[model samples]
Target chain A: MDAMPKWADVVLIPLISLILAAILSALVILAIGESPTKALMLMIDGALGSTYGWGYTLYYATNFIFTGLAVSIAFHARMFNIGGEGQAMIGGLGVALVCLFIPWPHWSLALLGGTIAAALFGAAWAAIPAFLQAKRGSHIVITTIMFNFIAAALLNYLLIGALKPKGSMEPATGKFPEATHLPNMHEVLAPFGIEFSKAAPANISFFVAILACFAVWALIWRTKLGYEIRAFGHSESAAKYAGISPTKIIMVSMLISGGLAGMMAINNVQGEAERLVLNAVEGAGFIGIAVALMGRSHPFGVFLAAILFGFLYQGGAELALWTKIPREMIVVIQALVILFTGALDNMVRMPLERMFLAAKRRNKGAA
Target chain B: MELLTILQVLDSTMRLATPLLLACLAGLYSERAGIFDIGLEGKMLAAAFLSAAVAYTTGSAWIGLLAGIAASLGLSAIHGLASITFRGNQLISGVAINFLAAGLTVVVSQSWFGQGGRTPQLAGSARFEPITLPFAEALRDIPVLGPIYYELISGHTALVYIALLLVPVTWWVLYSTRFGLRMRAVGENPAAVDTAGVSVVGLRYAAVIICGVLCGIAGAYLATALQAGFVKDMSAGRGYIALAALIFAKWRPWYALYACLLFGFLQALALRPDVIEGVLGFKVNGQLLDVLPYILTVIILAGFVGKAIPPRAGGEPYVKER
Candidate 1:
């Protein structure tokens, strides 16, 4: 057997799988009595046409970037932290508390306060599952999944009982103080004489998400901690022999992952909603698994995958609003993409690898 | 607690535990054959929707049951194909199935019923009725045994009995039957089973198919016996709960019964928090009650109560290496 080239493995496989998923999605749309091509056009236009579209897309991308990076970091440690959903929910609680109680003179200082609070809350949520996996031999997947439900229940209890505004029927907290409000893209860009969409929710958190990508890239590829994490993931016994404590590595990687996931609260809660909503996470944590898989668990890959999903989410909303297509259809489309890219990946890879290997053999014979 | 109150709680426990028992047993078969099936929720959801739709259309609960079983088996086949034939990652395949079922159930429900991801309510014979035992009335006056027979056991739907019966059957088959030995061996060491000339793929597919059938019954019970119609996302994380119960049971059939009942008891308490608070004279938060099962699941997974050892090859796809 011959190995696939780096370019083909990294680029070609996912590209083809994505195309396959797109075709299947088109077929589903057509079956629902809609024009597939027209749907595609609407999706592109609604998600990427102008500053408004880009604003929503970037806002969603920001959320995905945090979650996708969280999943990718854990994947490097051979851990599946499905509790990102729960961690983010708790992180939102942290942000809400910070914005509610503390009096910040400026948004910058508030942002710093909210970030630390969110990270600590999220890491605390993840620490239990990490400890279980390391010391108790419990499966991280099961424990983390259970934590997601528990987190939802906890958030629900808090919002309705302790966090709700006075005499409000809705299960949400009061808006943050005006000083805690983050500047949106329109406000940020206007100073440079650049016009942007005012109503768009994309804020300074988008830049923070981008910065996170760079930080994650450096941490994974250029740092000793990253090397140890990857080494432990690749071979647990080998890492143990090399004096890398599984308990320490698991705890640290999961804490970092949880913190990153928690940081997504700054984008959705402080930046967009300006309040803690019940469903602030909105399934981004689950979508992060698909993004991480599609991106090959690399920082750059996760960034691109995040944008694509952000487009799907914003575009899917447009489809539901404008057409007969149900909002559930987007979930179907997303599932197909995940199915092809993550589960049935070998269906595409095996054939491509064979073709590449055949070509290499013929070239060698000719030489 | 009064004796009557105890009987009522036990009765509610029976009703609540039915679906969990069925799904947990379903998982037992599949996991014992080295196939990890986290898609039980998806299969149950699919079955619940299909059964309700069919029952509404045909006006026959039996036909609905058959339809639900067939739909569940179809999903199991897909899981088997991905994990067994294509040798894909079992967890990823299970997750995809879950997503597929969630989306497909809603899409199909909207298209078929035009009721916005819900089925029309089944009335009269289209819904399951509690079966009265031959001597239930006469046995109702026997003091200690009266409430036990009439209230706690006798007046439930037929599916509950079937689920209870499956426990012993599952135990017998896994320990006493030839195919059961092969299935266990395949889970523990597929290479050894292969060397013995027993087809690993065949045994696994059989296990998955059985899982599908049981999950189908579980779903049908929820839609028809418990509720009169199917609602979107109706499974509501029950499959994951069942998987947790399976872990808590340590993959044994008899223990699966107790684990499901314990969970069911918790659910019954959570459902009627007012009754519990009145009896215990302590106000309980409904949301905290809801979180108990999940928190317990995590505790069990962490081996706080007892260690859980998974089948050696549970998540691995069987590949014959030369």
Candidate 2:
């Protein structure tokens, strides 16, 4: 009884939305008196042309992967965990605390410690809003948003007062010990005789991000909890009739979502920054929303969407450096993608469904 | 501890609260009419930039206000098109608008001004100037009432008075007129209103446009009246605080004013922590006050302090059943 095939539903729709967004983005660049074709060439050359560009792109992709998964899981549960920003920021704090206070003998142990701390802190941050949403009737969207501001204030205080290193005027912690320094892509790939840009921040965390994709794919498709979560999302009343606990589903999904989001701290704060910075998460948390939307909340789809966004981000930086195009161009592109894919989805979908139905009727008549 | 210091803090609170009050009221109309808009921040940010840019270019504050309203209305139209016409996710549409403004304003401002996403400083006639009440100097000798009139109420810009004046007007419109009754009813039960032969779409759009106008004024006040120029991301979190205030007020008009003022007082206290430090006999952390409104709102949200129930049909796009 579906209007179109599953492949078209999953792939074709997002593709069309992306193309429409790209066209609008080209017009926006043109409106600012820049050549769209030239900008495209620059983006390709900057993001995908060399190993260096790939290194930076993959680094950003790592951060996006974690966040995108966080958002994807929550989207499956039909809960908007907009507090990814806060959770990720708190995850950075956890990473900072673990790195600065704990003495690890090797990077492997440190990574494990940081990862555990990040997930726990991130999950704990999400738990409060999840608790309220489950027990009380408070909207998760508003509560998560309020939490973002609170997280920012909390970070601002800790960075200035307690976590700050002596003689450093900046609101950031001191660097982690050399024992905890992560190996870059260059080092990680050296054994295979492959060269990567050493200057780039792409590191072992990128592999972790890839593993997370597989894990999320398996978890969402293969697990009993996933069944309950999806069933609850599809119909709360039906799920309740089937004996699924709504409160448990809400809490468990949010905790996993928050944990995935927190894993981004391992990539950005631990892998890249080395020392936790005030603007550690930046707007990557919000970008996760667009990634999840465009990906249709599928892990494999999320991986591709994250790569596309990472390319836009790194390419936009290149445009800022070389041309008159501002870096906010990527943001505009992200917004357009979200608009076309998420909000105005039916605008594109309704027409496509009619065309498909007509084709199906024609094929049946010919048979 | 001193009377003058307390009066000064209260004075600062009035200025800080103006933007929050206007935005809270803006949210009031939209949520009351069954269209949830988290894009108020985005609208305010856009309006702030456009208003500052226009005022700087035309050297007229009024023209800037108009331009700001125009920008906000444009965004509102997009929201209406997506949510009302296409029946898309309202929250998704709102998130898009927010990102749109956050990015577009910076792009446009950087290209137009070349001041790195900032408008040029607006001077006299380009910005709102404070208006002194009549005979304020004549009453300066009076002990308590003189300072209250002169320091607290008399020296605000036109928008402050406009914001204060809108409270009662809003209350009257929400409770009095036929349009007001339809607006409230559309939010609560659009089907009921539709059954009563009212166009639910028309009423919702009207509510959205009203929301846009209020956000426009709120942004204009932030840039032209309060700061005298627009910087990138200058709207900051006032939009979110206004949202918290809206929830705190339970979507009523008068309570919005009180909530905004209370939040604004916290803002004022954060700005000058010495006043708090002197009283507490210890240095109070600035971050705590900055985080207070959010925590308080969360408490209200959790039903620990008070209950805040939203409009029944809020956040759901209305579809006519065949």
Candidate 3:
């Protein structure tokens, strides 16, 4: 068995995977009759080509970071919270209700209220599975998956029936009031030649995502609660012996994870679309698993991974516009990333290290 | 009129329950052999697609069913390779298979049929027509039991009979046969089975493949018998419901059939107005009724019926040292 490192496995694994993923993507590009050099340049150009593109990338990355962190936090406690999609949906519902029903005097208060409502709703949604797992010894994976279905059905009903926008044929709720929309920071910055529309859906959510990352890092490294959670994750029996309640940690961890997912909905409602819409999350919760895995459950790593995915999203759209590749190819690429990441334990780390050492030796011989 | 309606409801219940019964039996075999076969949904989806595609092309229901089984077996072989050979995580592999099947079927179907999702409507000759037994016809003349007989036994497509027949065969293989003993042993503990000189991988592969075949039949039944055409995601988590039935039945084949039937009854009731009125005593939202089967699944899983004891080493891959 490999020994645990003193620093952090999270720091090393993701960096290695990213580099390996880049190399693999290069090969894929080559096989598809695309020049790797031009593809790289195009991707960079598309992602950062214009200010609007950069804004859009950041806007997308904001949601990815929130949901990715939500998954990563649960992963740290050795729990697979597959219900992130459900939680995010509940959050979106909360935001929609607040935006539609609650009368807010200002946008900031509306945004805060909507976000908090989302978090609370998401936590409540997740709490059911956590309770079942903790109290009844029901497996979390199976229960969460079931809950995901229930949530989807419930959302569908709500969107089409009670929450349906007036006079709209689409199965979606009404748009939020202008007062409830997240203030366009991009608009404010545009006069300074900041180029905001190119930013897609950019808002203050990016700062919140960064702050959330730091908070996650501090919670994991600097607090007693984090220690107990980590201990329980490592070994339930050992954690119990150390006077920590494994059940409590599991429940709390799930709630926190789910709450974060709810917060991600704010990015959609307040930041991006400025209204609750059908299929708003759009598999971001599932893709969050890939992000969390690629990040190795670290907050900072999740932040970086989310940005990489954002780049992929933006570049993929650009590729579709400029080249023959379908936009769905990005989904294929994302799936491949998850497949590689899941199997990373078996394939990525040691082999790459060995190859790197071999290259160093060849260089030394030449010298 | 009320009695006639009840009989019609009963008849529909059995028809609806048939696919779940077949899929549950499929889940039972693989899970009993210690493989967590959550890919039942994917297998069923693939089989449904393949069966519909073939039946639509060849104008033969039998050939369509066979094609479905073949497709399921091929997909299950991939699952076997990943979980049994590569020792990959069963849950992850299952999830991956579901994603791959969902996307691949849609992609291919779009390429072939040129429709958004659906294939061409199957012809009458390419669909499973209701089987009418002489006894059931004669019995239907009787008052209550006649309707019950007609509803429960007669008028179902051929797959329902196949599913009901499978229960006895499953019981026999699980209890009396040497392969059944080996499968049970492997599920409980592969190391012990290996120590007893049985090939764990071979046994697991067989169980999973059998599961695939059953799921294929179930899928074909859904397409040809249940609806006479394929719809995207028509399986619609029925596979998961089958899995829940497997657990609720304590992994017993006979008990699993009943569990599946109960869920099937719920599904049929959800769709049938008379049964819903009789049971709930009032009209309910169709959407709420649609959620009843899943809610029941969760409740059963939460120990509403009894405790669920899974195979000891169900999700773990088996490795042997020489």
Candidate 4:
């Protein structure tokens, strides 16, 4: 069978699936006694209408970008690294320790230290599962998921036992020193006279997320290591015969993935909260899977998908605030998107493929 | 003092283990039939919510249990349709189901009852009441065995007994029945089973439906028997823990029982701070204990415990041409 045209395959199918998801979401809203068109308008207005909205949207987009790249890297190695939630938690710990203990004279230096520490800690947490999968044939999915819960419990222990402020009842660390606070989007954009929201959490870390996407693209598509990782993912036995070591590919790819996941903490923890808190990751790791899948694991595609989700999140918040719709409806919308895009993907693709095939046949007959 | 402490721990273990055991057995059926169901949590959550809502409305726990089973079966059918019928990725479908359940439970609950995604508190006949065995008063005078029989074994909701009975029933069906053999065969090698003239899809659907039934009971047990009503995200991570237990058991029924009990014991220990305080002579962090099942599952999967080989055809959808 002939493959579908690249343009149609890459662009058309996802577009159709997304439309289907949106239609279903709209129907669900109608069932709940709300107007779907109005909901969409509210979402757009709240997410993209103002600098304030963009600030929040971009801040969320930054988190998604880090996690999407993380998931994409592991997908390239044929590994499902579901431990991102846990990995990011540990990464926050690393960021907290660096910002708390190190007396950096400048915010930039603190950012550098925290980024390195977060990546290292995330990598370390991921290493155990990677090694087990490489050496012992443990299923990466099961092990990584287990690690997520373990990470949560481990973080809980640290916060309650050692990390909590001397007399604070809350299970969170004391605020970081002011020197470690990253520049918000307003401050960063003001030098260029681009007015932005002062209160929005979008910060310098957003740039870092964009940079990470480029690095991942270069690593996955351009480098020799990238070739080996893709080769292993495509066919491990064939790649083994071609001299790619499964152990090396799996371990390296997962380490990079874990590092990317950990870096997400820099955006949320150091960049926004300026402190380590419980549930800081807030299901962003799980959301990454959908982002990576929707993006087709491409860097540029991931960027677009992340922004779309950012819109949904900010807009969903608006819908909850203004309409009688509960905040959980956002999850339903997101889930429908995932259902159509990731799971029932073929429902859109097979028909599109058939249509493309018939068009080619018609052209042949006419010629 | 020691005996009483032991009894208390054991009692809590029994209560906690019931849900885990039911869910683990549910996963076992699906996985054994070659469908990887990570959606057990979702199914349980749906069941828990629907059952509570129905029970509260109708004032009958029995009808609620039926409603929960029907809701769970509906979800199981969706999973089967996506993974088996549409030939989509099983893991992705499972994740979607989980997300759907989590979101839908809250949305529907709010529409129906309007208590921030919670059902009204179940009371009277709407809840599962503890059942005391005959001669409980007479048995109380006896020492260790008496407490074990009357306290630990008896005097719990009927769902606990049903879950315990399912262990042996699951074993008998899987080993002694033709359907069980065919189900196992379908999981290990669907092509071989197809070649033998048995319908692979039929067996898988059956396994999935049974899995849904078990998950429904587990959910009903949680909402009605244990907690008295449904709360949002009430299943917590128990489904994943049950999956881990299924892995630790290496997909066997009896071993699944043991694995669930062990996990439940860990959970009970974590919940009861006094237990650790009593044993260690000081506070031992419950968080560590809270994470013990997950940590142990990772270790077990890593081959520190033993070798665990999943069904060869577990995640693959059988395509005849391929």
Q: Candidate 4 chain B — worst ten consecutive residues by lDDT sum?
A: B284-293
Chain B TM-score against the true chain B, each candidate: 0.97, 0.98, 0.94, 0.98
Q: For model 2, how does the per-residue alpha-carbon lDDT over A1-367 read when each residue is reduced to its tens digit?
A: 9999999999999999999999999998988889999999999999999989999999998888999999999989899888999999999999889998999999999999999999999999999999999999799999999999999999999999888988999999999898878899999999999988899889999999899999988888899999999999999999999999999999999999999899899999999999998989988989999999999999888999999999999999999999888888888898999999999999989999999999999999999
Better of 2 and 3 by lDDT: 2
TM-score of chain A of each: 0.98, 0.99, 0.89, 0.98
Candidate 1, after superposition: displacement of residue B188 in Å? 1.3
lDDT score at residue A75, model 4, on the 0-100 scale: 89
Query: Per-residue lDDT for B161 in model 4?
Result: 92
Whole-model lDDT per candidate: 0.90, 0.93, 0.80, 0.90
Model 3 misplacement above 4 A: A1-56, A164-171, A188-192, A311-335, A343-367, B134-151, B278-281, B319-322
Best-matching candidate per DockQ: 2
lDDT of 2 by residue, B232-316 (tens): 8998988899999999999999999999999999999999988988888888888999889999999999999778999999988
DockQ of each: 0.71, 0.81, 0.27, 0.76
lDDT tens digits by residue: candidate 3, A36-59 = 677667778999888778887887
Give all TM-scores, in the order shown: 0.97, 0.99, 0.87, 0.98
Evaluate model 2 with DockQ and give the value: 0.81
Which is the better candidate, 2 or 3, if ranked by DockQ?
2
User: How close to the true structure is residue B307 of candidate 1, measured as C-alpha lDDT?
Assistant: 83
lDDT (tens digit, per residue) of candidate 1 on B106-202: 8778878888899999998888999988799998999989878988878888999999999999999999999999999999999999999889999
Q: What overall lDDT, based on C-alpha atoms, would model 3 receive against the true structure?
A: 0.80
A316: Cα error in model 3, Å: 5.9
Give me the displacement of residue B2 in model 4, in angstroms.
4.5
